[model samples]
Target chain A: MAKTTTPPDQNGTKTLSDQAYQRLRSDIIHGVLQPDEKLRVEHLRQEYGVGASPLREALSRLTADGFVTAEGQRGFLVAPMSEEDLADITRLRILLEKQALCQSIESGDDAWESQIVAAFYQLEKVEESTDRDPVEWEVRNHDFHEALIAGCTSKWLRRFYSILYDQHKRYRNIALSTEIPRDLHQEHEELRNAALERDQKRAGDAIEHHILRTAEITQRVLREESLQKKERA
Target chain B: MAKTTTPPDQNGTKTLSDQAYQRLRSDIIHGVLQPDEKLRVEHLRQEYGVGASPLREALSRLTADGFVTAEGQRGFLVAPMSEEDLADITRLRILLEKQALCQSIESGDDAWESQIVAAFYQLEKVEESTDRDPVEWEVRNHDFHEALIAGCTSKWLRRFYSILYDQHKRYRNIALSTEIPRDLHQEHEELRNAALERDQKRAGDAIEHHILRTAEITQRVLREESLQKKERA
Candidate 1:
C-alpha cells in the first residue's frame, strides 16, 4: 500500500497510531474497508495486530479526516460514499484546482516547470507500461497533479486541494475499472502542455473537463450499482 | 461557552471525547489555550475533568481539525497562529464564502430570507447592546453568517466555508480587543439587505469587504505584537 501523502515525523519514525491511521485511511480509500462498514475496535485490533488503544486513536483521527464517522458512545463507522458527496467534492476540486493552476502559471519559476516535467514523465511511463499496478499509477498520478499546482503559494489552497483530491480519489478508485473508455493520457498531456506554456485558460479548462468527465462516469456507475442492489433486495 | 457549530448526534447525547473536543476547540479559538502551547495529556485531563483516554481522543480529533498539531510520540500542541496563516485562511474564507453567498442569493426562498432576518435580529440585538458578551456575539455572528449561506444547495461549499470561518476566528479572537473601531453591524446590515434583495453581486461584494476589513485589522495587530515580542527578545 502507498503510504499517505503526509510525510513522516521529524525523527523519521511512524508511531503505531500513525501507522494505524495510514493503514485504515488507505483501506477506506481503496474500498478494502467498505463504505459505512462498522469499524469495530476488537476486529481492527486483531486484524491490524495492534492493541485497542492505538486502533481507537487511529479511528479518532480518521473521524476528523472524514474517513470515519463517530457514533457517540457506539463507536465509529467508515464514512458512506454517495453521489451527492462525489459531485460536491468534484466541484470543489475544480474550483480550487483552477485557482491554484492559474497562480502556478502566473508565478511558476523554471524549477516549477522542471518539477512538472519530471512528475509527468514518471506518470507517462507508468501509463504507457503494459503492466500498470493500480497502486503505482495512483501514486504517480497524484504526484503529477501535485506537481502541476506546486507553484501555488497559498498553503491553505494547497491543503484543501489535497483533501479534495484524496476524497475524489475514493470515488475514482471505485470507478476505475467501470469507467467508460477515454483518452486520459491525452487529457493529462493537454494539461501539462498548457501549464508548461503558462496558458492559464487552457490549463484551467483542461483540468475542469478532466475532473468533470471522471465525475460523470463515476456518478453513472454509482447509480447503476445502487439500482442493481435495489433489484437484488 | 458556545457549543460547537456541529450539532449533536442522533442520540442527542455527546460522548466524553466529544465534550473534551468542544471544550478544547473553544479554548483554543478563544485563546484561553495559547497557540503552540504543549497540550500535556495530564494537564488537559485535570483541566477539563476528563480521563486520559477521552483527552487523547479529543486531541487526535483536534489535530485533524487543525486546531492542534500532533508531534508524533511527543504528543500534541495547540496549533500555532501566524499572520501568514491568518492571511491564507482569510483568503480561502473569502473565496468560499462569496461562492456560497452568490448561490444562496440566487436560489434563496422566503424561508431562507426569514432565517437571515431572524439571525440578523439576534445578532443586531447583541451588537447594539452595551454589555455585549463576546461569546454571545460570536455565536450570533456565526449564526447570521450561516443563515445567509443556508440556501446554498451545495453542502460541500457550506462545509468548507464553515471550516474556513472557524479557522479565521482564532485570529479574529486574538485581535478583537485591539482592532480599530468599525461599523461591523452596518456591514452585516448591508449583507443582509443585499441577500434579502437577491442581489448576488451586491451580497458577494459585501461579504468580501466585511471579511477583508477585519482581516486587515487582525493582520496589523498581529504584526505589531510580533514586533513588540522581537524588541523584548
Candidate 2:
C-alpha cells in the first residue's frame, strides 16, 4: 500500500517529463484538473513549474494514454467525461479484469495470496477509519484490485487492465460522493475470498458484478449531478 | 481503403511530431526498424530530418502507444518481440474484436454493411493481384477488419482493438514469410459472410479461430528463425 502513493522525493530516476506526466495524469483522474479544460502550455508551465518542452512531452504521452486530447496546434485538453464514456470504460474493465482474475486464480502462488491479503487488509483499515481521505481510500482500493490480477502472466492483458482501471478511476473520482451505496468492503472481501479459494467462476462473477454495480452507482450519480447543474444553469 | 494508407501530401493538419510518430510506428510495425533497436534521437533526427523537440515528443507518444519503450534517461528502444507477446496480443484481439463485432452487428446500419462490402471487395482485389505488395495487402486487410466493427458505438472498445491490432501487425510483419500457410482469402471471405449475415456466434468463432491460426503460424515462423540464428551461432 505504501508503494501505491509515491512521495515526490522517491522519483530519482524519473525524468522531468515523466514526473509531469504522472502529475498531470493524477490531477486529471483526481479531478484537480477539470475535464474539458484547455491545457495551455504557457499556463501549465507556470502552474506546474515545469518547463515547456517537458510539459508538451508529458501532454503528448497523456494523449496516447487517453487522459488528454490533442487539439492540433491549439494544444491539449483534459479528456471530457460522459455517461457513455463511463459505461464504455466499465464494459472494458469488466471484460479484461474478469479474464485477468481467472488467470491469476490459476497461476497465483503463495506470495500472490499474501499480497492480496495485505492489500485487502490495508483497504479494510482505510475503510474502517472514519477520518480516512477519499483519495487515500481510492489508492488503497486500487492496490487491492491490482493485487488480485498481479499474477496474470499476459503483459498485454495487464496493460489493457491498467488503462481501463485508470479510466474507471477517473469516472469513480468524478462521480464520488459521501453516499455509501454498496457494501464496498464486503464486495472486496468476497473478491478476495473467491480468489484465495481458487474458484475462477466465483471470482469472475464477483468482479463482474462488482464492477457493473459500481458503474450503476456512478452512472446514477453522474445523472443527478448533470441534473443539478442544469437546475443551477 | 484509401484512407488507411496515408499520402504524405495530404497530411495538412499533422505536425512534424505527428509525422514522426506515424513514420516511426509504421517502420516498426513493418519491420523497417528491428526489434530491440536503440532509437538514438540524434541519428533519428538526421534520418527523419526532423527537429529534436518534435522527435522526442513523438518518441514519448510512441512509448505510451507501446511501440517504443523509454529507459529512464537512456533514451528509447523499439519494443521487443516474443512468442508470449504474440500469444497475448492474439488472445486480447480475439476477446475485444469478438465483442466489437457483435455490437456492430446489432447496431450497424445499411451504410455500415456497405462499408464492409467495399472493404472486402478491395481486400479481395489485392489478394487476387499478381504483384501486390505485402504492405498493400496488410492495408486492405486492416481496412476490411476495421469496416466490420465500424458500427460498434463504444469508442473505448474500438481504441483497444486498434492498439491490439497494431501490436499483432508488428508480430505478423516480423514473422512474415513467402509461405502460404493457409488460405487467407477463404478465411476473409468467411468472416465477411458471417459479419454481413449478422451471425454473432459464427463471426466470433470465425475471428477467434482466424486469429489463433495466424498466431500458430507466426509462432512457428518465430521458432524457426530463432533456431536458424542458433545454428549460425
Candidate 3:
C-alpha cells in the first residue's frame, strides 16, 4: 500500500503504463502477489484499473526485469522462486556488494559517511522502537543498504545490484518468520562501523557473511513452508 | 536490418511498443543513434513510424536497461558513452564472466561442448571468408560468446552478463576501425578449446585477456577520436 511516487513522462501526466508497472512491481516485490501466480491481462485490468494495452506494456517491462516470466501466448506469470535461483542471486550479490563496498570506501567523503551514519541511526531507531512497523522497517533497511553503496559511481553496477536485490527480496518476504534468530542489529552496527572506518576488507567479508546467513535461513524457511503445504494438501 | 523474430504476445501480433523497443535498442547498440542524443518523442514517432504512446513506452523500457536515460519531464536520451562507463562495464564483465565460465564448465555436458564447437566453427568460417559482412560477423560473434556461457545455470548471472555485453557492444561498435590489430580468431579458437576441454581456469583467463585487450584498445581509440574531433572544432 506504499504510494511510491512515479516520475512523470514528457506531458507531465504519469503514463497509465508507468502507473501499472509501479503498482504491479511493488505488489510482486512485497509479496501481495505470490510467486508463480498468473498475471492475466484481463484480471490485472480490473485489479489495477487500467486498460489492456497499458497492462501488457507493464508486464513486458516486468518480464525484462526478471520479475515476471512470459508464457508464450498465455500472458505472464510472476517469476518462480527456487533454491537454485536464490543461490545464483545471493552469490552474485556478494561479488557486486564487495565491489560496491570497496568503491564506496575509496571514493566516499565526509558527506557520504555522514549520510550512511544517518541512515544506519534511523534504521537502528526503527529496530529498537516498540511500535515498529514492518513496512517502515523494510524501507529503513533498504535505505541503510542503499546508503552503503551510494558512493559507487557505476550506474550499471548499481542498477544490476538493485534488480538482484529485489529478486532476493521476493524470496525473503515469503520466508519471513520469528523463529530465525539473527542479531541483525549487531550485524548492521558492525557493518556500519567497518564502513565508516574505511575498512573495505572487513566490510566486504561482513556483507558476504550477512547475505549468506540470510540466504541459508530463507532457504530453510521456504522448504519448511512447502512441506507444511504439502502435508495439509 | 536484421529481424530478430520478435516473440509474439497473447494476440500473436507483436505490440507496437515491442517493435519500437527492438528497433531503438538495435539502433542504439549499432551506433546508428549516437550517444547523448536527445530522444524527442515527437521526432521519434515520425522517425520510427510508430505512435506517441508506444514509442514512449519503448523508451521507458530502454531507459530501465541503461540504453536510454530519462531526464525527468524532459524525456529520454540515448545513454552517453564514456571511458569511465566502459571501465565500470568491462570490470564487472570480467568477474561475472569468470564465474559463468567456471559454472558452465562444471555444469555443461557433452551437448554444451558440441554447441560451443558448432558456434566456433561458424564464427571461424565467417572470420576467414572473403565476404566479411560486419553485421553477419557481429551476430556470429555474439552467438559464439553466448555459447561459452550457455552451460552456466545461473539466470541472474547470464542476464547481467548479457546486459553488460550489449553496453560493451555499443562501445566496440563506435570504436570499430581497420587500425588496432587484434588476433581475434586465435583468441576465439583458444577460448573454444578451453571451453570444450572444460579448462575453467584457462577459459577464464582467456576471457579476461580478450576483454581487457579490447577494452585497452577501445579506450585508446576513443581518446584519439575525441582529440581529433576537438582539433577539428
Model 1, DockQ value?
A: 0.68
For residue A68, model 2's alpha carbon misses the true position, in angstroms, by 0.3
Write model 2 residue lDDT over B1-233, tens digit each, in one string.
35656575556646898899899999999899999999999999999999999999999998988999999879999999988888888888999999999999999999999999999999999888888778788899899999999999998888889989999988888888554435788888999999999999999999998889888998989988889989999
Give the alpha carbon lDDT tens digit for every residue of B39-111 in model 3: 8888988888888877876876787788998764467899988889999999999988888988999999988
Q: Please, what is the TM-score per model?
A: 0.92, 0.92, 0.85
Locate the minimum summed-lDDT window of 10 residues in model 1 chain A.
A6-15
Model 2 chain B is weakest, by summed lDDT over 10 consecutive residues, at: B1-10
* Model 3: DockQ score: 0.36
Point out the higher-scoring one by lDDT: 2 or 3: 2
Each candidate: what lDDT? 0.87, 0.89, 0.85
Residue A2 accuracy (lDDT) in model 2:
57
Residue A55 error, candidate 3, Å: 4.1
Q: How would the docking of model 1 be graded?
A: medium
Colliding residue pairs in candidate 3? none
**C-alpha positional error of residue B187 in candidate 3 after TM-score superposition, expressed in Å:** 2.9
lDDT of 2 at A147: 96
